[model samples]
Target: MTRLPPVPWTARADLAELVAALGPGNLRWVGGAVRDTLLGQPVKDVDAATPLLPEEVQHRLAATGLRSVPTGIAHGTITAVLAEGPVEVTTLRRDVATDGRHATVAFATEWRDDAARRDFTINALYADPVTLEISDYFGGLADLADRRVRFIGDPAERIREDHLRILRYYRFQARFGAELDPAAEAACAELAPTLKGLSRERVAAELLNLLGLSDPASTVARMDKAGVLPIALPERTPDGISLLSQVIAWEQAHAIAPDPLRRLAALLPADVRLADGAAARLRLSTAQRKRLSKAAGRGGDDAMDARALAYRLGMAEALDQMALTGGDPAPIVGWTVPAFPLKGGAIIARGIQAGPDVARILRMAEDRWVAEGFPDAGRATQLLEASIADAKIA
Candidate 1:
């Protein structure tokens, strides 16, 4: 008899219209939308389930002038694009076959059967869109109330159904777990090796998502102890966990936002080669790979001021290195690295022949400018004259 309290998403007219188009009794709010709503947390994505087939759901949506996309039609999912945001409406389905990486599913009409095929109990709760009544086929209500993430039927069976659940178990545990469900933990540990079969993109996405959470250090340490971390990221050292904890502490103290890539950098050894290798294995974007590589080296003792470091390395990477090395970011907080004033053209205009000499003189002037702490354009001109004098004497 649990009821969902009034939430912001449920009041949207477009959602109501989609539900009405799908039919009154056939659809209900399900999955994370329901789970987060009941927990009083802000829900980002809204999802629903219906006994109606995907084609029927699409037709009904079109009839109501709502746009529907076959986002995952093979899995009985169709996305209803509303003005507020996209709500994924899926037909109820039961797994016909699972190979730990993917599943072959058959559409089902019974809600309980569909819910039974889900990975976690708390994620299987459904709420009637109109009456707000919750339908809990498993012990989802109690488990959710206890903030425990328990697999729906059997932990090993669920992990066998989808190997990615091994990582997902820890991620959900970090988000909502009060105590480790011993069974799920054991199953995840035993089946951790199966994660290698998943796509590198999927693995990277989940790992980054876990690190993106608020204070995932303790959960990551637990994952390390459970033998899951080595399989997911073999490059991690024992000290990296403690380092990650320190990084999180520094971020919190400085009121800096949590960054997954920066945290990942902290979890790695201070070696540029290893950072590049990890970035390659994770299939990270070019910019992300460069940032990770830049953050791999140790910081705070280079003797260059924060602005100098910021100028050499981009500002974001500088801040990340500073935080990872326990250096104060106060100096770089609002400071912008000023650009060098003198250019090669100005050196050529100074009666220096436009050849290697101009390039050489420009280099010397720029170096002096940087060394002198990036003085004003006027001082830069004086430095240029000094460089010209030095070059003539040489």
Candidate 2:
């Protein structure tokens, strides 16, 4: 039997205090925190499973002078903000009905009853905040030690409960599981069609999370081979898949910048039709949408010329684009584009009338400025005058 690592005593004490304040037998540290603690991963969020309903949890949290948010009251979840951080407390629930995409659940009091309803074994592990003792209604501890991500019951049943799990299965495998259970793989294959019923935003969010995990190229390739990608992004090109492995490697080497737009831009295809509709459907931020547009429009020529490079993308974005494509972006120098030395006002001041000619002469001057290695305003003006004179003779 593999021995689990000891829980962080400091975190346990903190949670114990919160549980004491809420009263014993009312809450238990649950979900990812428990599972991650056993696996030795740094816990990011602390979650609690409570017998009390959402309203009760809210009232109790209020007494502690901590803010409470009804994040998912209908689903029996209340977010309590403590001095250290926010903890999500959800009441025990059992699924009354499900339609592959959403679940209608009824509140319950039994921990095992709640455990039975969850998606995976590893996710069902719970710990008593006061005693620090773990309660594994399912074989979550074993699965974690084994490095497997098995469904709680029948894999098909779990997938039917939430089709998003099809993508999540692969994501978990990429992150924690070293091998895929044959039955789980088969179930995902059978239910791959149900993924189409899910919202684009849901699918995009899951896909992005999966991408954020380890070796996204391999994970994406596995998803593609399993036929999950088609339901999520049907228009993705063959080249997209071919490029993904290289992109993943590049991203890994670069230590992953915090900008989601830059990361999303690297994954986007050169074809607008492939990226535009998906970006809109996912409701990506305006910056992300613009980055995708620029990435698609520029294609592999993103690093070709200084003007194209500086005008189309920032230095960091240029480096990301180069890294994504597995090229050296060092050629794209950091030279600032000398501000277009001749604005419309400047052109008008030079006796260029305020008509279409004003716009035209400015364009001509800008071209001369760029051609003259982007010199200062005075040199640019001299070059513009010489070009205008030569054009008149022609």
Candidate 3:
């Protein structure tokens, strides 16, 4: 009888009270919380499985003076807001029908049925709240011990149920698996086109999560070879894998933290149109879209310093360009960009009237300021006067 070791979240008073209200043996710790705990990783989101339906779960929660939110009532899930954080309690579910993107599910009385519907074996493990005993329906413990990310049943069948699992397979394997499951890999490759039908938001979320890993180069290469990359990200070049490898190496060598968007930029060619298209397909936020477009390539001279690049583009995007281009980021690592000091008003105060000429003179002053290595406000005043004099002379 493998039992969950004593963990802080399992001992939370609010969580315990909620469990008591739900009934001693009715609810059990399940999914990522149990898996992460068994792997000795810090659990972030605590999820539980229960036999009680959503309404009954809510009624029980109300009796305990705890507020329940029907976060996913249609799918038989209710969120219990606890002092520690939110713990989601969902009823055991069996898929009534699936359309590769969304599933129609029905509450089930059997825990194995719920576990069976899950995508991966390792994620199906459950733990009793009171006894802390683990329930492995499909050799989840064995698979976890082996560091293998195998599907619950048939790989292709699981993928047909939800196309997003294709990306998830690679992500989980990248994060946790020692090697790819051949059947899973083959199924993913054959069904790669199915991912095209999924919502771009779903594809974007999973792709970003995969890129956020410590080093996803090998996994990405696998995805590229398996015909998954072309469908998931159409902007990638043939040499995208090599570029991604270089970027990851630079990040590790320079001790820079892994950033998902920057890594995605590495996989793309130095073409803004393609980058923007990819951003649009991914449904990235407006700011993120702009950053991706700007990071398509370096904007200025090849000999441009990090500070100059940082000045042109914002800090974060500058770092992306440097990392992608194999430049050292240490120069601007903690350097706060000095403000240009001279605004249009300051230029006008120097006797330049408010006109196109004033704007032009302000530009000249700013150019000189940047060219002079971003000096102090005093230097800016001197430069403004010099520029005004130069403008009158011109």
Each candidate's TM vs. the true structure? Answer: 0.93, 0.82, 0.96
What TM-score would you give candidate 3 relative to the actual structure?
0.96
Q: For residue 130, what is the lDDT in candidate 3? A: 82
**Candidate 3 lDDT tens digits, 1-394:** 8999999988889888888999878999999999999999999999999999999999999998889899999999899988889999999999999999889998899999999999999999999988899999999999889999999999999999999999999999998899568999999999999998999999999999999999889999999999999999988989889988998998899888999999999888789998999999899999999988888855454677889778978899888888888888898988998788878988666565788998888888888888888989999889988888888743
RMSD of 2: 4.0
User: Alpha-carbon error at 99 in model 3, in Å?
Assistant: 1.8
TM-score pick, better of 1 and 3: 3
> In terms of TM-score, how similar is model 2 to the real structure?
0.82
Candidate 3, residue 326: how far the Cα is off, in Å: 0.5
- Give all candidates' CA lDDT scores: 0.89, 0.74, 0.90
Q: Could you arrange the candidates by lDDT from highest to lowest?
A: 3, 1, 2
Q: Which candidate is the best by TM-score?
A: 3
Per-candidate clashes come to 0, 0, 0
Tens digits of per-residue lDDT for model 2 on 228-338? 776777756666766666666665665544443444555567766667766897777676676677666654664355454554467655655665557654455445544
Error of 1 at 116 (Å): 1.4
Off by over 4 Å in 1: 336-343, 351-394
lDDT winner between 2 and 3, please give it.
3
Q: Which residue pairs collide, candidate 2?
A: none
